[model samples]
Target: MPQMSPLSWLILFMVFTLSYLGFLTMNYFSTFYSSKTPSQININSTSHSWKW
Candidate 1:
């Protein structure tokens, strides 16, 4: 088999890193939002009750 050029190797590395970062970012946001929603709902209810 033929060897890959340096540019091709660089491109492949960049694509892999970017995809991995994207996946991590997506997972982080999903977990963050999931944890945040309950607190937000509680805050909203508390604020609404305080208004009365």
Candidate 2:
């Protein structure tokens, strides 16, 4: 079995945390934009229907 140095452990932890945060951020923005687009489409449809 091999033991890792403190610095190596620290780097690994940092990389994992950063990747996790990035994934969460991407997921959040995707959901946020998806919701926004649907609402905008609904609004546009309503406005167009009203004009007729």
Best by lDDT: 1
Please provide TM-scores, in order, for all candidate models, with all chains considered together.
0.53, 0.53
Model 1 TM-score, 2 decimals:
0.53
lDDT of 2: 0.76
lDDT of 2 by residue, 1-52 (tens): 2376877889999999999999999998787433456545644334434554
Per-model CA lDDT versus the true structure? 0.77, 0.76
Off by over 4 Å in 1: 1-4, 32-52
Give the distance in Å from residue 38's predicted Cα in candidate 1 to where it truly belongs.
14
lDDT of 2 at 41: 67
